[model samples]
Each structure stands twice: as C-alpha cells, then as structure tokens.
Target: MPAKWVRTFAERRPGVDVELVDCAAAEAAALVRSGTVDAALGRPGVNAEPDLALIRLYDEVPVVVVPKGHVLTAADELTCADLADESCLLPLDDVLGWDARPGTQLSHRPETTADAVELVAAGLGVLVVPMSLARLHHRRDLTFRPLVDGPAAPVGLWWSEPTSELVDEFIGVLRGRKAGSSRGTREPVAKRSAKEKAAARRERLEAAGKVPPRKPKGAGEPGARRRRGGR
Candidate 1:
C-alpha cells in the first residue's frame, strides 16, 4: 500500500522525488520529529505522538501466516479462540496489540517479523500480521488466512503540523483530495446576493441622478425622528 501511494504521488507530482524509508511502526513518529524524513506512513494510533499531524490512509486487515497444509486452514476466517492451541510466533516488532492472549506465547521472541516468518517456515509457530506484510514475505511453503477478530493496522501519512508546501501536497495526494492547486488552496469568491445586487444598482442610479434620492422614514414608522417645528 505504501508502494502504491508512493507511485501515485509521483505520478501526480512529477517533479517531486518521493523516497521510501523503512522503519518500524513504533519508530516512524520519532524519525519524522527528528527531521530525518519529511513525512512517514505508519499506524497513527499505535504510534501517537504530540505535535505530529497525521492523515489516516487506510486500515490493513490482519492475517495469520502459517506453513502449507496447516490444520487451521479449515475455516475461512479464525478468531482468537481458534488460535488457542497454536504457538503464535511473536516478533519484537509485532504491531498487532491483542487484548486476549492469542494462541500459545513462545518463550523466545524473534527480533523481527521476517525472522518470525523464518521460524514459522521451520514449523516453530504461526505468525499473525497485516495482509500487506504477509504478501511482502510470501514464500512457496507459507500461506495466510484472515484473523477476523484481530485488530487492523491503520496506515496514516504523518508529518509536522506546520509543514512545507511540498509535504502538504503529498498529504493531499495520499488523501486523493488534489490533482493540482493542492494545499493552501484559495477559497472561491462568493457571488453577490439578489438583494445586495439590487441595492447596489439602485445606489449607482441615484448617484448618477437617474432615480429619486431615498428619503427618511415618516413619523408613523418605527424609530422615526420627531419634528422640532422651530426648524
């Protein structure tokens, strides 16, 4: 999805050279705040930080990748209960924050999801991750199934709130809001109302002596001035 966003952004902004930086979801906000990168795409809720403005792109469906011909593949989808007996291979960089204990927790944790995938291939345990990551590290012996009750990994475009025009353009691009005249777009001029237009026309006519001057309200009307009789 990040790749797709980058390609689309490049097509829309031909001049801009979008560079993809690989960092864990936890570290993306810090990298952006430190000015190492102009912007980043990560799970905003998972990596919430103060003063960082974010635009949510989309949510990634969670899937558990297991070895080919695994017994769990019987169902079209599985919940936390179905995974109770399996040893879930959890990496240090795991993004899915499950409230319920998912499967059997391993005593040793893998350093990364890629490492966990290797362990899964070696029949160590199953690894639950975003569908994107499953496809990313796809292998002939591995397959994934949707974990229906799992939390989604929401994608977001994050940067400093008061960012440069280029960064704002990228934000709009990710949001599908602009093709051109991107951010800081000028507001459309409002058309004059019928009453206002008529008033202006009457004023122009009166100024040119084309119509009689408007007179003050008579004494019968509300807020009318009383006559002094001496003047």
Candidate 2:
C-alpha cells in the first residue's frame, strides 16, 4: 500500500525523488530519530520517542509458510491447534506472540525469517510470520496460509519535529485526503439544499459584480497591494 502511495505521490510531485531505504524493522525507529531518513515506516507496537509523531497505518495478520503440497495446504486457514503436531521454526525476528504453542519446537531457530522460509521449503519445518513478510520472502516451493488466532502486526508512519510540507503531503495521501483540500481550494461548496443553493448563487453574483461590491481592504491607504498568490 505504501508503494502504491509512493507511485501516486511521484506523479503529483514529479520533481521529488523518493528513495526507499531497506533496514531491519528494529532499526527503523533509530534511523528516523538519527535523521538518517526524513521519515520511517516503523513496525507496529514499537513505542516511539516522545518527540516523534506517529500515524498508525494498518494491521497485518500472521500466516504460516509451509512447503508446497503440505497437508496443511488442504485447509483454507489453520489455527494454532491444527499445527500442534508439526515442527515450527521460529525465526529470530518473529513478531507474533502465539496463544497456543504452535508445534514441536525446532532445536535451532533460524537467524532470520528468510532463512526460516528456506528451511520450510526444504521440508525441515514450518515457519510462522506476518503475512507481509511471508509474501516478501515468497518462494515457488512454498505457500502461506493465514493463522486465524495469531497476533496482529500493526504498522505506522513515524516522523520528527519541524515537519516539512512533503511529510504533510504524504500523510494526506495515506489518509485518503484529496490534494488541495487543506487549503480550501479543491472541493466546491455543496449546493444541494435550497438555502445552500441560494447562498451559492449570491456568492456567484458577488464574484461577477452583479451585486454591489464591498470596499477593498486599505484601498485608500498608501502602497496597498491586492492579494495575488499561487498555492
């Protein structure tokens, strides 16, 4: 979803170049705090600094990645109980806290989720992770199924003080706010009701000089200029 937003932002802001920085989820907050990046997309539930601003994006559910043709694939989804008999590989970076112990635990946990996924592909064991991570490290030999009872992963946008217009624009886009809406320049005033229609007509007449115009502010003052500006 952020990628899609980036594309839209780029079109609207053609001169601005957006660079994506890849880092461990644990490092995201620090990177933002240190000013290494203008903003960071921090992992869910990671308490941010008091000075930082946070906007919650969405929650991603946990899923299990298993080797192709595994019996668990027969079901559309699975619960922790259903996976109790299998060997579950818990990656070092695993985020979800399971309600039920998944399966016989592997003696050695993989160093990373990607490695855990490789092990799953090799038929060594199953790996559980957030749906986004599973898709990120997707393998042709492996497939995923949503874990119905697993914990959710909430993601958010983080930024520091003295925010820029670019950050405001991105936030607006993320929240589905139309461009220029903040400046009262995009949407026309609703004229559905008779009262509203009459007001709108009066405004049009004023704009067109059909009605008597009010005195311009400071018209008789020395060196007073009209309001001329572009947004």
Candidate 3:
C-alpha cells in the first residue's frame, strides 16, 4: 500500500521508485544506520540504535483468538483470567508478550503466529496476539476478541538522522499526511487542466497519424506564430 501510494503520488511528478524490504527489526535498524536503506518500519521500542530516529505510526491492541463455536466467541473483550483454565498457544519468539500472561496454563508454544492460529482452529488452545497478527493469520473457523487490559503494541517508522527526499516522501504517506505537507519532501504534481489534457491527447493522436494536423492560430494567439515558424 505504501508503494502504491508512492506511485500514485509520483504520477504527476515522475521519476520516483519505491522499494519494499523485509527483515528483522534489528537488521532493519542496522540497514538504516549503514545507509543501505533510507527508512525502515518495525515494532516500536524494539530497536534502540543510537543513530536511528523512530517515529510512532500507530498502536495495535492485543487480542485473543478462539474457535468459532468456542464459549468466548461472543465476547467483545477478554481478560487474562478468562483464559485461566484454557490452554493458551503462544508464539516461539514471544515478541507480543504473550508469555507475560498473568495466570494462564500455556499448553503449547507455536513457532509463529500462523502456527498459533492453526492450533487455535484445531481446538488445541487459545492464542493471544496483537490484533494485526490475528487478522493476518485469520482462519475461517476462528475468531478474535480484543483484550481490554492487554499490552498495546506500537508500530513505528525508523530512519537515519539524514534521510533522502524519497524516504521522507514515504514517511509522509505512512503518517497519513497530505500530498503538500511539509513533512513530505516530494511535492505533488499539479493536475492538468481539462483543456491542457485534451490538447495533449490531440497532439498524440496527430503524431500517431490518427488525426489531421490542427490549423495555425492568429499571431496574437499566444505563441502560435512562433510554434508555426518552428514547424
């Protein structure tokens, strides 16, 4: 979506390219510090590199995933105590802090959010994770409910102190800033007027031999005489 936004924004300006990279939070921060990548996106507070600047993008609430017919399916929000007797499936990395559950019996530890979701669908146990991860690994037979008092995960955009214009443009888009916002280094291209667009279309058609050449206008009609002389 960021790349798509960059492309749309660049349509009028031209000469812009957006590249997407995937790596661990630490690795991404290292890339930014080394100037390999202009910017990086990752979980907030995950990378504390000295030279990298972190910009908070948004916060995601943690949630609990259960099977469709499970007793908690109708719940709007769940608490850690609500899962006391239930076996909770947690990811191996524990990045979302699922292991920090106050009083729950963890029956299994899956390697990834995807694995946890699958376990939940198979009735192995319930899984606690960030709302985005739950949605990412959503299963047809499984549903999620927000954890009212659970930890909130913050997502952030990171970049070196001195970033390039292109990186700034991407950051602006991620922050939902307008095209002309100062936070974005690249200016939006001015839209062509209807008359100007039609004139350009006619020129293209004429060049393609699908339309006749337009008649020259009067000398006083702007630069018509100069254009005619050049032709």
Candidate that would win on TM-score: 2
| Alpha-carbon local distance difference test for all models | 0.82, 0.81, 0.73
lDDT of 1 by residue, 1-231 (tens): 668767877776677798888887788888998999999877765656667887777899999899989998887898878898999888888877655658889999999999999999999999999998899889999999999888888888779868887777667767776554425233434568999999999999999999998886553566565678845
Tens digit of per-residue lDDT, candidate 2, span 158-190: 888776778777777777776555522234344
Number of clashing residue pairs in every model? 0, 0, 0
Instruction: Order the numbered candidates by lDDT, best leading.
Output: 1, 2, 3
What ranking emerges by TM-score with the best candidate at the front?
2, 1, 3
In terms of lDDT, which candidate is strongest? 1
Could you estimate the TM-score for every candidate?
0.74, 0.75, 0.67
State the lDDT of candidate 3 residue by residue for 43-156, as single tens digits. Answer: 764445666788887778888888998998767878877877878776775556443675465656777767777878888888877787788778788898998888888777
Off by over 4 Å in 2: 46-51, 97-100, 183-231
TM-score-wise, the better of 1 and 2 is 2
Worst 10 residues of 3 by lDDT: 218-227
Between candidates 1 and 3, the one scoring higher on lDDT is: 1
